[model samples]
Target: MTVATDTPLVDTHFHLYTRDMPITSWAWHHPPEDASAEQFLALMDQHGVGYGVVAAASLYGQYNDYVIRCCRKYPRLRGTAFVRPDTDMYTLERMKADGIVGIRLFFRRVPDPPDLNSPEYKLLLRRVRDLDWHVHTLVSSPALPEVIRAVEEAGVKLVIDHFGKPDERLGVDCPGFKALLAAVERGRTWVKLSAGFRMPSREAARSYAQALLRVSGGERLMWGSDWPFAAFESGVTYGQTIADLHDWVPDAATRRLITADTPMRLYFGA
Candidate 1:
């Protein structure tokens, strides 16, 4: 499908995985086929995306060697990895030097979320801040307020994944979503206009995106395909994923901001 925006697109979230990579845990019964860097780049080319950020898959835990390798291999690609609070500053500095622009915190499927208020977590955030990296989180809506408060208090730039993974039934009325809006107003947080299927209905997804547009405008919002779509891969197609942006963000100017300008600034520093 042809993208309507004049500006080049950048997918702010995608993943790369191979069978050879060890899996500590998985969101589903393992993907039927590998989603490799080579395939990701081909998809980008097919869809007119000039740049991408390869977010570390939680299934691989903290084994970021492959992603680091991809970043080094492709200048147009950047990455984020799953990291523990105890991860030392030296390693973080090394990762940043290797083109990792952010650190991901996955709280959605875990039994308990990290204690963001703890000293260890605070120290990690401080180190991340010092290195000029942002915190990318995939968290449930109910936990967003605390996470938002903690990230803001730590003075780290925040990127919320998949529309804060809001409850589709509640849409904008969800308390977690309300907190997301408030966080955007604070000026340090960026929300992805992505993973529309995560919401209950297409209408709900559009409502949430429109809510963000009205409150935060395009500056604090970006677009992502969630490529290879993990467990949902069978049902969703890359073309449809790119096409959804047109539906959710109808205005060309706003679409440009989300698809190109905002992402370039956030992930590529362009």
Candidate 2:
């Protein structure tokens, strides 16, 4: 069936992994089924989604071979890479040439994030800036202030994953959520409207979305399905993700901007 909004959607967040890849020792959330680019694209195609931005999975650490392979093979896909902070410009340039548009910072699970002010990370962010790439991050709300400051200070575009992952108990009133809105106001950060099912409830997701729409004023915002559902896969479907977007933002015009115009121009330039 066609998407109700009839927009050629762009998914800005999703992952691709295979069991054969070298998983990191500290990996979390091992779904028995692999979420491959082919499978995800098939679902996208079925749902009228024209393009997607494949997020780098932290579960595999710096083993980005599969993501690189998929981006190279499918022009419809762009991706992020997870690499060591000390990785040089040459490798980063190579990754850019392979259709990777950004670097990913997976810090939600890390008790102590890497020092973004340190020499190694500073250089890495600088190199990423030179490529005109963004630093996509999955950081908890409490840790957001430091990360936001460091990334924005580096003059790189920052995309926060899963609606800035605000603390459930605090919701919109939380400092992290407020920090996100402030960053959005500065015009360098974009929040991924994704993974609503991961929220404490549908009402919480709706409240967060409404707050973001108010703060962003309909810019620097895009929608994603968080496809394959990963840790929360058992009861969800891609179609429902689309339906959720409709429910969250009832206006067709606003949805057109979120699901199509913004993301298509941002990722695929279509």
Task: Give me candidate 2's TM-score against the actual structure.
Answer: 0.96
Give the deviation of candidate 1 from the true structure as CA RMSD.
1.7
Q: What is the lDDT of residue 231 in candidate 1?
A: 79
**Candidate 2 lDDT, tens digit per residue, 102-213?**
9998886654467899999999999989998999998878989999999999999999988898999999999999999999999999888899999999999989999999
Clashes of each: 0, 0
TM-score of each: 0.95, 0.96
lDDT of 1 by residue, 19-68 (tens): 78888754544777999999989988877789989888988887899999
Candidate 1 ranges with C-alpha deviation above 4 Å: 1-8, 26-29
Model 1 collision count: 0
* Candidate 1: 10-residue stretch with minimal lDDT: 1-10
What range of 10 consecutive residues in model 2 has the weakest lDDT sum?
A: 1-10
Q: Distance from true position, residue 260, model 1, in Å?
A: 1.4
